[model samples]
Target: MALLPSTRAITSSAQALDLIPIVNSITSLLQALNPRNPNPKNLSSSPLNRFSPFLDPNLVTIVITKQTNPFHALFFFNWASNPNPNPKNYTHSLRCYEAITNLLLHHSLFYPAINLLKKSQKLSDFFIGKIIKAYGDEGNIKAAIFWFNQAKAIEKDKYLYSFNSILGVLVKANTIDLLRTLFDNVVKEGGFQPDVSSYTILIRGLCKKGMIESAQKVFDEMPCKPNSFTFNTLINGFCKKGDMESARGKVDEAKTVMSEMWLNGVKANAATHLNILKGLCIAGRSAEAIEYFRWMASCNMDLDAKSYIVVVNEYCKLRKIDEAVSLLNGMCGRGISLNVISFNSLFRTLVELNELHRAILLLLQMPQIGCSPNYVSYCTVVCSLCRTEGRMREAGYLVDDMLRNGIGLDATMYGCLLEGYSEAGNEEMAMQVFKEMIGKSYVIGLESFSVFVKMLCSKGMIVKAENFFEDICRTFPAVERDGYRKILDEHQQITQGSIKEHQGEESS
Candidate 1:
């Protein structure tokens, strides 16, 4: 006896229910609908398409109203909102905002999902606070403020996001007047309570902008006691401004706050120590800075390259070249690599002391230590070579090394070589360098060309100097031609006077 058609269909539907869950296990499958995908053809024959009749809005509304497990209903609603296939009637049909908002209202990932929606330009200003909070978390207060302004422009009713975002950005930017204006506007408009983070950012900004008294007033007037981040920010700000007394006071306040019920978890770190050391160094308190650097080392805080470079620069500036070198050598011994800035500092000091050979040696070590000489480093060594006796060959070798290393030789390098040759009484070599400079299309500014011309005129080669001057005028059309004309007139006067004097002497 064969089964009836209706009985066969009921049994088939029961079997299909077991396969539906397996098919729906794929998460966020809508992302596969991108036009770039090559396989929408595969989805055309999918079993999921057979359930299309059950995905109507009325069915979804019934599920939402009658289902005991709202989670499953919510998932269905989300899927209904973001349909599997574009409707044959419409070009675009996905309700991205409705789906995201539904997820936001019911999901654990409310903030992140809202942010994803905002990034897609699908979220509205109703979620502005959440968006602002997201931006603040990412340290993008400026972007937060921009979006807040956009929201305000779109809708006249100001929200908390508008106040907080503007205040946060102004505080971060340290625009005191802008922050005050925003604060006053928020207060006048009413119903916006400034958070601790807002106050902390403002206090930090004020102290950073050198308004310690104003910062203190804000600190004192806060509704709640200050947290460690607040105190730490102020302390760091004071340290940056070289106000050690205020910095110490803030440190004490941070200690007090940490001991109390609040535990702000923000204590002084390497940045704080480094800032204090810099302030000390600037005040000519090298001994104290060195002591602090040592103390930080004792605490196992790894000193950054800039910290070492700053101390090295201070030593060099004070004419303590040996001390600078010793510090650099000590840093190298400790497996702390020197950066290009530090290496260049030491090289410059050695060059200043007329120790060209030692400077050259240090320069060679630069590549081994992963420090490459920038333009300043090359210029420094070249200038030192030009000044030192019998270093012309070395200077030429340095120039070759620069070219080999792919470091460009600009007008300064050419100028240095030209001046060196002129000073050495090698006028022909100088002319050759000038020609090379022109051939290479280097920017030979008026000052360098004028120097070269003066060198030629001094050697009684007035015609060559005039020709060089004319070539320069042609190259730089915007340059005032009067300066070059003056040089030409002077050369002519000198030449004519010399010839007349010679003729008179011969006649006599």
Candidate 2:
């Protein structure tokens, strides 16, 4: 049914409408209606009494629809219908109920919507389905089950949608045990039969929790046929598990399903191909995975950023830098924007392969390719180069470049430079970096702090080390004190033992 014009108008209004007074009016009415309030005087002074002249049920419903918070509507509904309600003026029409209920659901006010349903004088499949969905959305498996059981008393047709909603909630919650029981109940019940969607939900939950065999069992036992989403869920589940054997098995299974889909005139789309590609990558079959990726390009399948990233990461893992770069160029030519993640993958691989120069080249080229390098991109190369012989100076230059580009030098970057300087025995530069880092927002990581302290001690600058340790204790009082305690204990033990030896010598 189409919405009322007034109802539609209020919801689309862009202004931030205030409903606090309306809510206050209704809540006050509720309190006055309560018999327990002994001092129930001045009913005429209540806001409801004052607004009664303008409180048309239809008009108030429009206001309810406009309210951002559903509680306001619930309070308004209660006030309208609860106290000495006039049949002609105060009755909540079906349209009014639907409006408020939908508004409640839109705001994710599940409990209020459910309460509305329970108190509703009229119940329908729509309201029941909404209640079940609301509970599911709340991630309240127990509440969803309670409502499902409550729905059993509802008519069979009404219960059907609510039942499916509950099952879907179970699937989302990964309540496998409850899912099994609910699936059994649907079967054991005389009239209701589980639909493809119902089975898909159960299968997806199983697959997600790594129950591949059980998911397959449910797939095989399906009385109805499965759709692409059903197949995709299982395929993606296997890939995410990262178990090579199972991933391979699932890949073959997915291929079989795709073949069946083709025979049935259901064409495999990009998502279908992407799932298989992900599985192949997880199985470490990079060669086969690239073949599929190429096939996608040949078929003109639209490849998204994720698809590019998956292929890029797989190629990087196999140390196929040239192939990965080709994919990046191909994406650019095809008008696909490369995200930071794909670039980072290439950066990581280059650094790992000890191709620091190549990694730096790519990092510099990132902005030209429309992908700005993030902190990780710069830090990965800088830290890697800092570990190499005679490359500390270059790493320091990269940090300056990062700052010139308006990318702030974070704690990790500072830590990297400090370690590099200390390792290179450039004590002056190390102390400079340490001083600049002391009061910054980025708290240095514990390991880096330890390295800085040890570097000072190893340089025979004991007084400087002591002062630095005192600064640390003052600056990061919350830092784990064990490192400080160990250092202090060692120094104390040396002093005490020397004093005892000196006393013994004096006695001799």
Candidate 3:
């Protein structure tokens, strides 16, 4: 095809008018390639008739990258690939295969994409790596490992990077033993030199599994010196474990490692200090954590949201609400945006103090500050209101708001609301809540169901209560029907006895 005339200039209006035919030619060519066209074969064939022009690797890239309707382009590509109705006359180019692979991955089209890769005649190391990564991403560890082994046997040198990718999958999959086997034998015995990334992956995996000692051994065995990321990973792992005694030891280790890095001309960054502060906080040494934060600030370290949340949470846990709020204000004043964790910490504390009005106001203000209320925030406030007397109405309003905003109503919130309505003698509201929970397929536990049943029967709705029991039995087939009947009978007797006492008192 000839080049389209430049839109930039054609000397003058007269020359520009002359380029209309060329512009129309380009437009017509694109129109012919439109995948939405019923007969895509009516478009020109390939330059050598090796394939359809639409299936040309370069054209496929153009379709994906330049075309407005890539979905239609993919459909046309699939149509070209189909063996029936119109068999493909040509082989797919490597770029075409890769383009389709990426397209599939973009749409999270994993299984079909894997099948496509597995069924291809030209299985390159690059395609194999993509398959391994796709399987790993989907958390199909078994598939990832299987493909990785195949890649190693087929082409070790070309697939060295695949080993690192496989290690990452194993780490995420939590297959520590298999990870070790691959690292120790396949990676080493296969004559593939394990890089720093290889060591880091193993160390982090072991730390995640609480094999901190094993992580340490791997660190010491690294052929190359550990980088800042490697040190940070180890430090963060120890902090997450939350053992005070072990944390102290890890603290000392972190210091020694920091000093060695300094001697080696690698200065400590904010991440390095943040890990230590988080460690101190988790180890119940909040005072030390605050002091470290102050020192880090004094040195002008850029504190992130995680750092602020940790300190604020520690203060809140110690019942130092004033201190926690002050720190939160300080974070905002310094232009740090509060995240969900930051808001939840203070929201919980205020609710715990029975400061419902203040808590509700803060909850409403969350979105203005770019921190939208999550399920935890809504559930916390709703559950708290449900706990207080004369606040069930307010909790119901919150529930309505939650549903409107697409926030999920979890079992804990439902249980609290059910209990509130039951205690308030609002059988109608309790029944309504029970039905909503059932409609949503929430499993009503025995305790919650008991509360609802007692509420229903006490209000003299024995038949309705019996129906509820039957429905619950159907919902939970494992629950013995006799046990439910026994509960209904007990509530029935209690209601009748109370009614008798009331009648005698009225006559007296």
User: Which candidate leads the pack in lDDT?
Assistant: 3
lDDT of 2 by residue, 1-508 (tens): 1112233333332233334444455544545444222123443333445444335555567766765555555655666665343433556678778888888777776666666677675566557767777777877667777777777776754577777788788878878888888788678875767788888888888877788788878887888878877777666665664567777777877777677767757667778888888888877788898898988888888888789889999988988999999999988998998889888889899988899999988888888988889888898999998778779888988888898888888777788888888778788998888878887735666666666666666565667867766777778888877777576446545555766888999999
In candidate 3, clashing pairs total: 0
lDDT ranking from best candidate downward:
3, 2, 1
Can you write out model 1's per-residue Cα lDDT over 1-508, one digit (the tens) per residue?
1111232343334224333332233222322332222123343324234344334433334334443333444444444544556352211123434443444444344454555465556555556655555565556666677777777665556465555555666666557887777776765666556677778877877876878678778877887667656765655555554455655544444334334423444466556566666666655667777777778778878777778888888787776877877887778777887778876777778887888888888777777766677777878998779766578889988888888888888887888787777667678888898888877866566656666666677678888887877776677677678877886677668767888899999999
Model 2 misplacement above 4 A: 1-108, 118-123, 237-240, 400-411, 441-447, 457-460, 478-482, 485-508
What's the residue-level lDDT of 363 in candidate 1? 77
Model 3 lDDT-worst window of ten: 45-54
Write model 3 residue lDDT over 1-508, tens digit each, in one string.
4554555644434323444444344334555655453235555423212223223344444454443443444544554465233333545567777777777665566665666676775566777777777789898888888888888888856676678889889898988998998888865575667777788888999988988888988887788778878877777676765467878777667666667667867667888888888778767778888888888878888888888888889888887888887887888888988778877888798888899887887777777766788999998898899879898888888788788778978878888888889877888899888887777767777677777888887778989988888887787787677877887888989998999999999999
Locate the minimum summed-lDDT window of 10 residues in model 2.
Answer: 1-10
TM-score of 1: 0.65
* lDDT values, one for every candidate: 0.63, 0.73, 0.74
TM-score of each: 0.65, 0.75, 0.73
How would you order the candidates by TM-score, starting with the best? 2, 3, 1
In candidate 3, stretches whose alpha carbon ends up further than 4 angstroms from where it belongs are 1-128, 138-159, 186-192, 242-244, 400-412, 431-446, 452-483, 502-508
lDDT-best of 2 and 3 = 3
Error of 1 at 88 (Å): 22
Compare candidates 1 and 3 on TM-score and give the better one.
3
Look at candidate 3 and give me any clashing residue pairs: none
